[model samples]
Target: MSVDTFAPCIFRMRQTYVTDVVRMHLEIFIQPK
Candidate 1:
């Protein structure tokens, strides 16, 4: 694949992973003791 196309895919994956980690952290933080 071309570098231009591959770059976006990698960026998107990184963004998705970051969002998922943030969501998981939020969920844990929101849980009641």
Candidate 2:
């Protein structure tokens, strides 16, 4: 795979993973109130 294509795919995956984690934390800690 080319670096240009691979880099964006990896970046997008990381971004999605981080977003999921942040959403989970918010639901667990902020939803209780």
**Top TM-score hit:** 1
Which stretch of 10 consecutive residues in model 1 shows the poorest summed lDDT?
A: 24-33
- State the RMSD for candidate 1: 1.0
Model 1 scores a C-alpha lDDT of: 0.97
Q: How accurate locally is residue 4 in candidate 2, as Cα lDDT from 0 to 100?
A: 100
TM-score on alpha carbons, each prediction: 0.87, 0.84
Q: Using lDDT as the measure, which candidate wins?
A: 2
Per-model C-alpha lDDT, please? Answer: 0.97, 0.98
Instruction: Give stretches of model 1 more than 4 Å off.
Output: none
